[model samples]
Target: MLAAAAAAGAAIWLTTAWLLNTADHAREGTDRAKVRVDAVRTGLAAGAGAGAAVGLLLAFRRQRHAEIATTLSDYDAAERRVTELYNAAAEQLGSDKAPVRLTALYTLERLANNDPSHRQTIVNIICAYLRMPYTPPLDPTREADPEAAQRAAARRYHAVRGNARPAAQPTTTPNPNEERQVRLTAQRILLDHLKFDARVPWNKLDLDLTGATLLTFDLSNCTLSSARLSGATFHGTTDFRGLNLAGEARFDDTIFSGLTLFMEATFAGSANFGRAIFSRQTDFGGASFSMQTSFERATFSNVTNFGGVTFSKSFSFNGATFAGPALFSQMTSSERATFRGSTFSGYTEFNATMFKRDPAHELDETTSGWFDEFGELVFSRAADFSLATFSTEISLDGAIFSGDVSFRSATFSGNADFSKATFKQAVDFADAAVADLSSPPTLPAGWRIEPGEGATGLIVNT
Candidate 1:
C-alpha cells in the first residue's frame, strides 16, 4: 500500500512541475491572458494532487496500524484460551467422574493440537496429570451385577474347556490381570513428556508444583519443555536425572526436603528456581543449560553441588542463599554469567573452568566473564559481585572472564585467594572487604583496587 501511494505522489509531483514550467514559458513568449489561465490551471491541479497523495498515505498508515492491532489481539486471545484449557485439565484430574476426566484430557489435547503457541503448555499439563499417582487396588469379591459376572465366567470357561488346555489352568487369552497392567502402563507414558520443542510459540509453559507431594516422580529421559513447579513439595527424592527440557522450567516457592537429583540433565532451555528451598542436599553435577538459567532469591539449606556442570549459555544467581557448603569447582559457561547479590555460607571453588564468548564475536569488544589471577582466569565477561558475601574461603585459582569485573561492596569472611588469576581488563574491587593479612592476596599486576578505610585487597601469600 505504501509503495502504491508513493508512486501516485511521485506522478502527481512530476505533472505539477511540468505544467508550471509550461506556464512560465508561455508568459515569456505567448499572450499574457493565456499564460494567466495556464498558471491558474497548474496551481489548482498541484493543490488537488498533493491533497490526494497526503490523504492516501494517511489512509495506508492507518490500515497498517489496525492490522497490527488485530494480529496482536488474536494472539492474546489464543494464549488465554490455551491457558484456560490447561487449568481445566488440572481440575478435571481431581474430579471423581471418569468421563469428565477423559473429556478434560481430550480438550487439552485439542487445545494443544490447535494452537502452536500452547503446544508446550499442553504437554506440561498432560505430564502433570500423568505424574499424579491415582491407582487403586481392585477387589474381585465385589459383584455389582451378578448376572453379568456369571455370564463372563461361563464364556471364559467354555473358551478354556473347548480348547486342549487343562480345566484347572486359567484362560491365557485376554488375561484380566493384564487389564490393570495395561492401564498402569498407559499412565506411565506421561513421564515421556519431560521437555518440549522451543520452536513452538509460547515455548515456555510456566509450571506450578505448589503443595504437590510425590513419593518419587521419576521423569527419566523425559522432556519438560516449560514446566512450572511453584510452591510444590516433593516429600521423597524426586528423580529428574537424565532429562531434557527446552523452555522455561520454573521451581519457584517450592520445597524439596529430600534428595533432588538433576544429574546428567540437559536444559537447552531457561531454568528458574527463584525463592525455592532445598532442605536436603541437591546435586546438579553434570547438568547443562544451553540457554539462560537463573536461581534468583533461592535458599539452599544443605550442600548443593554443581561441580562439573556446564552452562554453554547465559546464567544468573542473583540474591540466592547457600546455607551450607556449596560447590561449583569445575563449571564452564560460554556466555554471560552473573552471581550478583548472592550469599555463600560455605567454601566456593571455581577451579579449572573455561568461560568463553561466542565464536562469532570472539575478538570484538566482547570479553569473557570467567578467568583466574596472575594471568590465569575469574569470570569471563562483565561478572558482577555487587553486595555478595562469602562465609568461607573463596578460590578463583583457575577462573577466566574477558570483560570488566566488579567486586564492589562484597564481603568475604575467610581467605580469598585470587593468586594466579588474570584480569583481562579493569578489575574493580572498590569498597570490597576481605579477611586477610595487610599485604593482601596477590592480584593482577596492573589491576586497580579502590582501597577503602582499612580495606585490604585480599592479603597476599596468606
Candidate 2:
C-alpha cells in the first residue's frame, strides 16, 4: 500500500510539473495567458502538497523498519546471553568443589525460572545430576563410640574454618558431608519447581531418577507426568502422599529401605512395582489406580497396607511375598484383580472388600482371561475375608491356609471355585452367600457342616 501511494504521488507531481512548464511558455498579457498562469500556479501548489505527503510516508516507513531491526538485534543478543549463561552454569556443575556445584544448581534453577522455554531441559539436567551415584554420609553420632563423633566434628570444624592443609593432588572422591549437601540441594531444586503453586511451575515433567539413591525424599502433593525410578534406592522416610501421576509410574526393582507412604495417591496410568522390595512398613491406603497395576514378585518385609484402595483396571500381586501383616480392608476392584501365587507369611485381611467386574467394561486380550484369582496362594497365618463381596467369578483353586480362615458374611454373585483348596485349621463360612454350590468347596471330611437360617448354601465349620 505504501509503495502504491508513493508511486501515485510521484506520478501526480510529474504531471503537474509538465503542465506548469507548458503554461510558462504561453504569452503573459492576454486573457488566455492569465488563465494559463493561474493554472500553472494551481498545478505547482498541488505538486508541492504531493511532494510533502510522499516525504512523510517515506519517513514513516524508514522509522518502522529501523524499529524492527532494533528489535531483532535485541532478541539475538538476549538469546546469546542466555546460551552463555546456561553453558557457564553447566560447566560449574562439573567443578570438583561441592559448594561450586551447589551454586551452579541454584543458578540453573534461576535461569529456568527466567526462561520458560528451557525449563524442562533444566529439570532434566537436575534429575540427571541426582541420577548419578551418591551415598549419604553415615551419622557418626549413631556409632557406639564417642571418639567417632569427636573426629567428625573436628573435621567439619576444620573444613568450615579453612584451616586444614590442602592436598598435593585432587582427590577422586568428594567429602561425604559436602557431597550430601549438594545432593540435597539438587533434590530441593526439583521439588521446588515441581510444586503446583510454584511461581514458575514445571508441570507434567517426566522424571528419570532411575538407579538414583535418594535420602529423605518427600514429594507430597506434587503432580508428575511420568517417572522412572527403576533400581532406585530410597533411604529415610519416603513420602509420596497425595501424588497425582498422569502417566506411567515405574518402580521396578526399586528398594525402599525406610517407611514408604503412598496414601491417597492417584495413578492415571499403569503403575509397575515389579520385583521391588519394601524393607520397612509401606502404606498405599486410599490410593486409586485407573489403569493396570502390577506388584509382581515384589517383597514386603514389614507391615503393608492397601486399605480402601480402588483398582479401576487389572491389578496383580502375583508371586509377591508379604512377610508381615497384610491389609486389604475395604478395598474395591472394578476389574479383574489377582493375588495368584502370592505368599502371606503373616496375618492377611481382606475384610469388607469388594471385587466387582463390570460386564460393559472391556478388557484387552492379555487380561481377558484374568479372573479374581487366588490360585496357589499360601496364607501362613489367619486369612480373613469377612463381609467381602465378589460380583464376578473367583478362583481359589489350589490355595493352602495354614491357619484358620473366615468367609463369614461374603457374598459371591458368580461361580466360587475352591477345587483343590486346603484348610488345615478351623474354617468358617457362617451365613456366606454362594451363587452356585453344585460343586461344593473341598473341605476336610472331619469338619462339621451347618446350614444358616434362610441360607441356601451349607456353612462349614472346622
Candidate 3:
C-alpha cells in the first residue's frame, strides 16, 4: 500500500509539472505569460511538497502495521506454547505414580508463574487434588501381627546360616509414604504462592477445600476472597493468624483436632463456624469482624480465648458450648452481641469487656435499646463481669447461674435487666453503677439491694 501511495504521488507531481511547462511555452512572449510561468512554477512546487508529505505518512503507517502484525504473530506463538505446557502438566496429574503427580504440581506452578492469567485455574486444580479422598498407607507387617512377623523373619534369618542368604527385613509399602509426600508438596506449593510478598502471589483466590482432610493447615498472613472448608478435618495445628478474608468464610461442621489460632485476623464479610468443633486450645484474640459473626452450636473442648476481639456487626454464640475456660476480656461490640442459650461449663470471664452503641451509628435510634443479649445463658462455673461496661441496655433475662457470679464495680450506663434470671448460688453486684434510676434494673426474686449514700447507688445480693 505504501508503494502504491508513493507511485500515485509521483504520478501527480509529474503530470502537474508537464502541464505547467507546456502552458509556459504556449505564451512565452507576453509579460503576463512570465508572471503566469512563475506562478505555475510555485504551484508545481507546492503540489510536489504535498505529494511527498502524503507518501511519508503512508510509509509510516505501513511500518506501524507491519510491526503490529509481527507482535500479534509472536503473541500467538507464546499463547500456543503456554497452552501446550498447561495441557501436558494437567495430564501428568492423572498418573497413578506419586512422583509423576509431584512433577505435575511443580510444572503447573511454573506455568502459573510465567502466565499470571492461569494462576487461579492452577490453584483450583491443586486444591481439587487435595480434596480427593486419600488415606495414609499403613505398614503391612504392622497391620498383620507385628510380633509374629518379626519372629518369622528372625527364624528365617537363623535358618539361612553360613551357605545361604539371610531373610529380608520386613518391608513397609512405599506407596502411602510417596503419596503423603506428594500431598505435602501440593500444600507447600499453595503456601509458597499465597504469601504476601511471594514472587507470584495468587491474590484473593477462592479456596474450595470442602471435606478435605488436611495436615497442619496453615494460611496465616494470607489474603483470601472466600474459603469453603465445610466438613473438613484438620489433623494438625491449624494457623490462620493475621488472615484477611474479603468474602464469606465457611467452616461449618469442620473439626480442628489440634490447636487453632486466628489471632489478629480480619473478617471483612460474614463468618460462619456453626457446629464446628475445636478439640484443643482455640484463640481468636484481637480479631476484628466487620460483618456478622456466628459461632452458633459450636463446641470448644479446651481453653478458648476471645480477648480484645472487635465485633463491628451483630455477633452470636447461640446454643454454643464452652467446655473449658472461656475468656472474653476486653472485647468490644459495636452492634448487638448475643450469647442466648449458650452454656459455659468452665470459668467464664467477661472482665473489662465493653458493649456499646456507636454514637455514629444511625441504625439504632433508641439509646436505651438493649445491645448485649445473654438471655437464657447458663454459667456452670464461676462467672465474672468485673469492670465490664455496657453503654446500652443489656439483658441477662432468664439466665441460669449454678456457680458464684460477680458484677463487682461494673458500669451499666443504660438499663441492666436481670428479670426472671435464676441464681442457684451467691450473686454480687457490689459497687455496680446504674445510670438510669428512673427505670432501674430488676433483681431476681428474694434478692436484696443495699443502697449507698442517699439514692444514687445500690448494691444487690441474691
Candidate 4:
C-alpha cells in the first residue's frame, strides 16, 4: 500500500514540475500526459484506503473467536466443580458419624439452592436418607403399658411380614437420639423446598418416603405431585391439614401412634388409607376426594370425624372398625359410599349426610327443608347406624333406605322426620331414643319410638 501511495505522489510532483516548464501554448502531448498521471495517483490512494479497512476487519474476527473460546472453557470448569461437590456430599451421607451426615445434608441443600436444575435430584437423595431403617426412642409412659406393648408387637410383626424394613441396623450404627437429629434435619430440608417460599420456591417435587419411620411429622399447607408413604409409621401426632395432593396419596398400612388431623385436604387422585391405624382421636373433616378413596379395614380407636366431606367417586370403608364415637355429618357422595361389614362400636351420627349428589325426594316426605336444599338421603345397601346419636335437629325426609336398614339403639334430639321413607325390607329402630316427647319425632309405619338406653335413649314401637 505504501508503494502505491509513493508512486502516485511522484507522478503528481512530476506533473507539477512539467507544467511549470511548459510553453505558454504547450504541445498537446504534454497536456495528455498530465491527465494520465492524475488518474493513476487517484486510483492508487483509493486502493490503499480499502486495503487498510480489510486488515482491521480480519483482526476483529480473530478477537471475537478468542473471546468465545474463553467463555466456553470457563463454563465447562464451573460444571465440573458442581459435579465434584455433589458427588462428595452424596458419599458423605453414608458415613457412620452423625455430624458428617448432617454436614452432607446441608451441603446438598446449598447446592440445590444455587442450581435449580439439581433441586429434584437433591430432594430424592434426601428422601432416600429418610427411608433408612430407624427405631424411635423409648417412651417411659408406654414402657410397661400392656396396650402399648401389644401395639409395638403388632407393628414389628407387620413390618416383618410386609418387608417394610431391613433385617436390622448393624451394631456399629450411631446413637438413636443423635441419629434422630440428623433425620429431622433431612426432613426439614425436604419440607423447605416442598413448600412455597417466594425467595426460594421449587415446584413439581415427588416424594416417596415409603416405610420410613417419622417422628411427629407434620406437613401442612403444602403441595405435592405424588406422595408414596405406604407402610410408613408416624410415631407421634401427625398433621396434614390443608394439603393439596395433585396425584395419588398412598398411606396403606400406615400407623399413626397419636392424634392425626387431615382437615380440609384435597386428594385429586385415589387416596388410600387401607388398614391404617389411628390410635388416638382423628379428624378428616371437610376433605374432598375427587377419585376413589379407601379406608378398608382401618381402625380408629378414638373419636373420629368425617364431617362435610365430599366424595366424587366410590368410597369404601369395608371392614373398618371405629372403637369410639364417630361422626359422618353433612357428607356428600356422588357415587356409592359403602361400609359393608364395618363395625361402629360407639355412638355414630350421619346427620344430613347425602348419599347421592342429585336425587329426587318424595313429594309427601315430611323431612325438613334442609334436605331439599342439598338432596335426598338414600342408603343404597344395608347400613348400620346402630348406637348412633343425634346432636341437633335432623331430617330423614324424602329418604330411601333400600336394603335392610338397622337404626337399632339410635337416639334423636330436637326434631326428627321419618315421613315418606321407603324401607325395602325389615326396617326397624328397635331401641331408639327421643329427646322431647312434647314434640315427638316423626316415625314411619312399623316403626315407633320407645325408651331405649341412656337418659334420652330410644327404642322402636311396632
Candidate 5:
C-alpha cells in the first residue's frame, strides 16, 4: 500500500504540472495536491484488495494439501491394519486346536467379505489349506450307530486293498474328526460365498483344488471362472449339479470313488477328464460343453449316464472304458464326437441321439485325430443303439469289432461308411432308416441291406 501510494502521488503530480499553463499551473497547485491525495487512497485500496486475494489463494492451497496428506495417511494406516489382520489370521490357521483354526478361517472370510480386493487372495489361501493332505474319518457321521459302523468297516476293507487314503497324518491335530469338521467349515465358507444366488457372490474367482481329498464335496449351482481339480480324490457322493465354469476346467487323473454327479453343468471353456477314474455311479446328465472336451482313457467302473447332453465343440471319448451300463441316450452334438478305440463291457444305449460332424472338422480321414491316441473308430465290445441318429459320414474303415453291435431302427442321414469294418459277433440293423440313397453303406461280403418298416427305412441281414 505504501509503494502504491508513492507511485500514484508522483504520477498525479507530474500529470497536473504538465497539463497546467505556467502561470495557471502555479496558481492550481492546491487543487492538484488534493487530486493526488485521492489517487493515492484509490491505489492503496486496489493494492490492499490484490494482497487479500493472494493471501486467500495461498490459504486455500495449504488447506487442500493438508486434506490430501491426511487422506493418504489414513489410507496407509488402513492398509497396514488389514495386512496385520490377515497375517494374524493366517498364523491362527496353523493352530493345533480345531476351534482355533475354524475361528481363523471365519475371520479371513469376514475380512474378504468386507474387502473385495482381498477375495481372490483369501480364496487361494483356503484352496491351499484344502490341498494339504486329508483323510476323512471312516464314517463321515462319526456316530456309534450300526450303519456308521458298517460303513466304517467297509471303508477299512477298501483301505486295506490299496484303494484310498491320500491324506497325510495330521501332525498338529491328531484328531481326524475335529480336523474334518474344520475343513468342512472352510469348504462351507467358500460355498456360501460362491453360491449362485448368494447375497454377495464372489464372481470370477479361480479355484485350484488340485490333489485335495474331499468328502461328500458339493459345489453345485456355483459359477466359477476357472477350476483345477486334477489328481484330486473325492470320497462319498460328490455333486456339481448346475455348476457353471467360465474358463478351462481340468479334472485330469482325478479319482471319484463314490457317486459323482455333474448334472446340468455348463462349461464355456475347455473341459478335460483325461485318465480319470470313476469307481461308482457317475452321471453327467444334461450337461453342455461349449468348447473342447475330452474323456480320453477315462474309466467308468459303474453305471455311467451322459443322457441329454450337448457338445458344441470338439468332443472326444477316445480309448474310454465303460465297465457297467452306459447310457448316452438323447444326446446332441454340433461337432465331431469321437469314441475311437473305446470299450463297453455292459449294455450301451444311444437312443434318439444326434451325431453331427461338419466336414471341415475332419482333421484326419484315414485315422481319427485324437489328442494323443489317434486310431480307427473301433467298438471292441457290445454297443446297442435302439433308436439313434447318425447325421454325418461315419467312417468305420479298417475297424474291428468283437462284440455284439446293434443299430435297430436308427436313422442314417449321410454315408454310413464302414468299408473295411469287421464284425465278429452278431450285427443287427433291424428297421433302420437310410436317407442318403446316393451313398449306400459299405458292408461286409455276407451282409445285405433290404427294405423294412417304413418306405425310407431299411434292415441289415448278416
Candidate 6:
C-alpha cells in the first residue's frame, strides 16, 4: 500500500511541474500553444486528486502498524511481571503473616498454567497447613510479658512458612510415649513424601519400625541414617540402591521379591534378617555389609548376585535355598561365615569366592549333616565349582551333589568329591560321568589310586 501511495504522489508532483512550464511556453506564442496549455491544466487537476487519496491511505496504514506493535509490547511486559510476582510471593508465603500466605497461594493459582514448579510448592504448603490442628487455644495467660505475646504470634506465623517449631519447655515431666509419638509422626511424614516421589533425600532420618509392612517399597537413592527398620518386610521389587544406612539397621522377617537391588549400599552396625525370603532375582551387587550380618533362613528364588560384596565380620546364611542359579563370583567373606543347610537348585557358582578358614574344607567334617542326610552330594545341574578354594574340611557326604561338578583342573587342597563320587576317582572323568563306569575308566592307563598313600579308600581304575 505504501509503495502504491508513493508512486501516485511522484506522478502528481511531476504533472504539476509540467503544466506550469507549458503555460509559460504558451505566453511565448509557440505553434499550438493554446491547445498544449489546456491539456496541461486538465492533467494537473487529476494529479492533485490522486495525491490527496494516496496521502490519506499512507497515514492510516502507519497508524495501524504503530497500534499493533504497542499492543504486543504491553502483552510481553505483563507476562514477565506476572512471572516475577509469583516467584516472590511463593518464596515468602511460608512467612508468619496469614495474609501474605493467602496472597501467595492466589498468585500461584493464577500462574499455574505458566509454571508448574511454583504451583506444586504452593500445593504442598497448603496441605501441610491444613494438617495442623488449631488446638490448645492460644494461651494468653501464659504470656505474662507483653513482648511474649508478640513472640508467640511470630512463631505461629513461621509454622506456615515451613519452618520447624522451636522445642518448647515441658509444662510437666514428659512421658516416653510422647517422644515415641513425635518419632512416629516424623516417620509418617517421610512415607508421605515417598508416595509423591520416592527419590526424596531423607538424610539423618531416624525411624522406629516396630511392626511396619514395607511391602513393595522403593527407597532408591535414599539416605537412611540412624534408621531402625526392625521386623519389617523389605519385599517386592524394593529398591534400596546406593543407600547409606548408618547406625543400627534391622530386618528380621523381610521378604525380597523380584529384582531387589541393594547396589553399592553401606550397612554400619548390626543388620539382622533371621528368616527372610528372596523370591526372585536379587542383586546385592557391590554392597558393603559391615558389623554383624545374619540371614538365617533366607530363600533365594532366582539368579542371585552377591558379587563384589564385602562382609566385615561374622555373616551367616544358615538354611537358605538357592532355588535358581546363584553367583557368589568374586565375593569377599570376612570372619567366620556359614552357609550350613542351603540347597542350590540350579547351577551354584562359587568361582573365585574367597573364604577365611579351611584349606581342604570337607563337605561333612567342618559343617555337619549337610551331605550325610541327603545321600547324593547334589552338584548335578552344571555346577560352576571352579577355582573356589575352601579353607576347612567341607563335606558333601550324603546330599545328591549331582550334575557335572566341574572339578576340571580344579586344585582341591583338601578332601574333594570324596564320600560317594558316583564316578570313580582317577577315572579322569574330566568330561565323563558315572554312567560310563562299565567300560575301562576314561583315565590314562598308568594313572592309579596310590595304595597305602594318603589318597585312601579312593576308587581308582588301576
Screening candidate 3 with a backbone cut-off below 3 angstroms (N, C-alpha, C), the clashing residue pairs are: none
lDDT of 4 by residue, 348-452 (tens): 666566554323322245653322110144444555666555433445545556566666666565455667556776666876667666556677786666654
Residue pairs whose backbone atoms clash in candidate 2:
none
* lDDT digits (tens) for residues 265-289 of candidate 6: 7888778867777777888888888
Best prediction by lDDT: 2
Error of 3 at 453 (Å): 9.4
Cα TM-score of candidate 4: 0.65
lDDT of 2 by residue, 334-433 (tens): 9998889999999999999999887668666776564689999999999999999877778887899999998888876666666578888887777776
lDDT (C-alpha) at residue 280 in model 5 = 100
Error of 6 at 66 (Å): 66
TM-score, model 3 to reference: 0.82
| Segments in model 6 whose C-alpha atoms lie over 4 Å from true places | 1-203, 225-227, 234-236, 357-380, 409-417, 420-462
**Best of the two (1, 6) by lDDT:** 1
Write the residue-wise lDDT of candidate 5 on 138-193 in tens digits: 87665557987688677777786896774453455457888889988988888888
Candidate 2 at 96: error in angstroms? Answer: 1.9
lDDT of each structure?
0.61, 0.84, 0.83, 0.74, 0.80, 0.56
As a TM-score, model 1 comes out at 0.43
Better of 2 and 4 by TM-score: 2
lDDT of 5: 0.80
- Cα displacement (angstroms), candidate 5, residue 20, comes to 16
